[model samples]
Target: MRSFVVSVVSISLVASAVFAHSGVKNEDVMKRMKQMSEMASNMKVLGAMMKQQQPFDLPLAKAAISKIGELSAETGKSFATKAEDPKSEAKPIIWDEFDEFTKLADALTKDALQLQSSLKGPEDLRNVMATLGGACKQCHSKYRE
Candidate 1:
C-alpha cells in the first residue's frame, strides 16, 4: 500500500513538472491551475488514507476536506473572467454556458461539504470521494478541454 501511494505521488509529481513547463503565461490561468493543483494534492493525501496506505487521521482528513470545500466554492470566481492561455485546459464552452459551468462548481462545493460532515472513517471517505470525483468528472467532461 505504501508503495502504491509512492507510485501515485511520483506519477503526479512527474506530470505536474511536465505541465509546469508548458508555458502557461496568463496570470489568471496560472491562478486557476494552482488552485486546482492544491486541491489535487489534498485529495491525494485523503486518498492514501482512504486506501489504507496510511493510517486515517480524522483531523487531517477534516483539514483536507475543508480546504477542498473552500477551493470548490471559489471555482466559479476563478473561471468567471474567461481568461485564456495556450496551456489552459478549460474549454470555450465554459463561457458560452457559464451558468451551467458554475452550477457544477457549486455542486462540487456542496459535495465537499457533505463529505466533510459525513466523514467518520475510511469507508465514508471512500463513498464521499466517489461522489466528489464523479462531480469533478461530470464538469471536466463538459467544460474542460
Candidate 2:
C-alpha cells in the first residue's frame, strides 16, 4: 500500500509538470485538468494491478477506488459553469447537455461505489474494471475531447 501511494504521488507530480505546459489559463479549468489527471493515474495503478504488472494489494486497490469515487462525485460540480481553457479536453457540448453530462458523472460515482464494495480479490478487480471502465468510456466518448 505504501508503494502504491508513492507510485500515485509520483505519477501526480509528473502529470502536474506535464500539465504545466498544457497552456490552460483558467484556474477552474486547470483544477479540472488536475482532477482528471489524478483519476487517470489511479486508473493506471488499477490497471497495473489487474494485469499483474504490480502486485495486487487489497488496501491499495480500495484506496484507488475510493479516490475515483470521490472524484467522480465532484465531476459534475467541476463542470457546472462551463469554464473553458485551451488545453481542456472537455467538449463544449457538456454545457449544452448539462443534465446528461452530470448524469454520466453520477453513474460513474455509483459504479465506483458498487465496485468498491464488491471487490474480494484480484479477480474481482478485473470484473470491477469492466463495469467501472465502461461507465468512464461512456462519458468520455460523449463529453470529453
Candidate 3:
C-alpha cells in the first residue's frame, strides 16, 4: 500500500510537472482541473499517513474522504456542460457517452462515501485505495484523453 501510494504520487507529480501551466481557457474546465488537483492532494496526505511518512491522522483521512465524497457527488453536474478547452484532457466521448461517464462518476461518489464511513485506519485506506483507483481509471480510460 505504501509503495502504491508512493507510485501514484510520484507519477502524478511527474505528470503535473511535465504539463504544468495548462492553456485551458474555460473557467468551468479549469474549475474541474482544480478540483482534481485538490483530490490528488488529499490522497497524497492519506498515502503519506498510511505509509507512516507522516503521523497517523484519522481525522485528516476522514476529512479527505469526506471531501472526495462531496466533490464526487457533483462530478456529473460539474461536467454537465460540453465546454471545450484544448488544455482539457477530457475526450469527446464523454459527451457522446454521457450516461456511461455519469454512471462511473456516481459509482465514485458511492465509493467515496463508503470509504469515509468505513475508514478506521491506514489499513482500511490501503484496501480501499485500490478500489478508488480502479474507479478513476474506468472514467479516465473512457472519458479522458
Candidate 4:
C-alpha cells in the first residue's frame, strides 16, 4: 500500500511538471510585463516634465521616447510569436482580433518615433505626448485589462 501511494504521488508530480512546461512560465511573462510597466512610468515622468514646462530636456526625453518605442516593438514581436502564452495578460480578444492588435502596435511605434523626432521644444513634445497617450489608450482599451 505504501509503495502504491508513492507511485501515485510521483505520477502526479510528473503530470504537473508536464502541465507547467506546456504553458509559459509566470516569471517570463512577468518580466516582460514589468518592462512594459516601467516604460509607462517613464512616459508619465515625461508627461509631468512637459506639464511643468521644464526646459525640454532633449536627451532625457529622447531616451524615454526611444525606450518606449523599443518596448512597443518588443511587445509587438512577443504577441506575434507567443500570443498564446498562458501567463499573458492579453485578452482572448487580442488573438481573435490579431490584425487589429498588430495595427495598434504599428501605430504605437509610429507615434513613438514621431515623438522622438519632434522633441524640439516643450510645445512639440506636449503634442507628441498627447498623441502617444491617445495611442496607448486605444490599445489598452481593447487589449489590456
Candidate 5:
C-alpha cells in the first residue's frame, strides 16, 4: 500500500511538470487574440465612416480608438508574460527579435494616440486612419502568421 501511494504521487508530479512546460491553453490564447481582432474590426469600421465623410461621430470614433489602444496594451502584456506559449499565434520571432517587436509596438501605440488626437474632423480622421493602417500592416507582416 505504501509503495502504491508513492508511485501515484511520483507520476502526478511528473505529469504536472510536463504539462507546465508544454504551452499555454489554446482557448485562453485564442480568447486574447480574438479581443485584438475585434478591436481591429472596430477600427476598420471607424475608418470607413471617416472616409465616407459622414457626420463625424465623435463619441463612437473616440471609443473605438480608445479600445484599440487598450487592446494594444493588452497584447503587449500578453506577449511579454506568455512569451513561451506556442498556442499564441504570435510568432516566435517576436522573442528572438525583441528589439524589432518593441519598435513596432511603440509605433502602433503612437499611431493609435495620433488617431485619437486627430479625430477633430473627417478629413483629419482619414489621415490618421492611414497611419493606423500602416502600423497594423507593419506588425502583422513581421510578427503574425
Candidate 6:
C-alpha cells in the first residue's frame, strides 16, 4: 500500500515534467490544470501537517479542504470540453468516459467535505489520507496522461 502511494506520486511528478515540455497552448486545458494544481498544493499542506513534518494547523487544513471541495465541484465544468493542447496531461478517455469522470470528481468533493468535518487533529487527518489519495489516484490514472 505504501509503495502504491509512492508510485502514484512518482507518476504525477513524471507527468508534470512531461507536460511542462509539451508546449500546451490551450487556455481551457490550462485552466483545468490550474485547478488540479491548486488541489495538489493544498494536499501537500495537509500531508505535511498530518505526517508531523509540520505543526498541525486545524483551521488551515480545514480551509484547504474547503478549497479542494470547491475546485472539485468545478471539475466537471472544466474538463467537459475537448481542447487538448500539447501540454495537456488529460487523456481522451475523459470525454469518452465522461460520466465516470464526473462521478470521480463528485466522490472527491464528498471525501473532502467528510474529511473536513471528521478530522479533529493530526491523527484523524492521517487516517483519512489513504482514502483521499486513492480517490485522486483513481481519476489521475484513468484521466490524466
Q: Which is the leading candidate under TM-score?
A: 2
Worst 10 residues of 6 by lDDT: 16-25
CA lDDT scores, all candidates in order: 0.84, 0.84, 0.79, 0.71, 0.68, 0.82
Residue 75 lDDT, candidate 6, scale 0-100: 96
Q: Please report the TM-score between candidate 5 and the true structure.
A: 0.68
Q: Cα RMSD (Å) between model 2 and the true structure?
A: 2.7
TM-score leaderboard ranking: 2, 1, 3, 6, 4, 5
- Writing each residue's lDDT as its tens digit, candidate 1 over 1-145 gives 7678767876887598557747888999988888888777778778888888778889889888888889989999999898999888999989998999889889889888878887887778888678877887998888887
Error of 1 at 130 (Å): 0.3
TM-scores for every candidate against the unseen true structure: 0.86, 0.87, 0.83, 0.71, 0.68, 0.82
lDDT of 6 by residue, 18-80 (tens): 566456578898788778877886788788777776678889889888888999999999987
2 versus 4: better lDDT goes to: 2
Clashing pairs in 2: none
Backbone clashes in candidate 5 total 0
Which runs in model 5 stand beyond 4 Å of their true positions?
Answer: 1-25, 53-55, 81-88
Candidate 4 residues lying further than 4 Å off, grouped into runs, are: 1-25, 53-55, 81-88
Write the residue-wise lDDT of candidate 3 on 18-52 in tens digits: 46537778988887887777667677777777788
Per residue, candidate 2 scores C-alpha lDDT tens digits across 1-145 of 8678767867777777575647778989988877877787788779888998788889889889889999989998888878987777888989888999889889889888888887889988777778878888999898888
Candidate 5 per-residue C-alpha lDDT over 79-143 given as tens digits, one digit per residue, 9 for 90 to 100: 66444346556777887877788777677776777678767766677676777777778888888
Better of 1 and 5 by lDDT: 1
Runs with alpha carbons beyond 4 Å of true place in candidate 2: 1-17
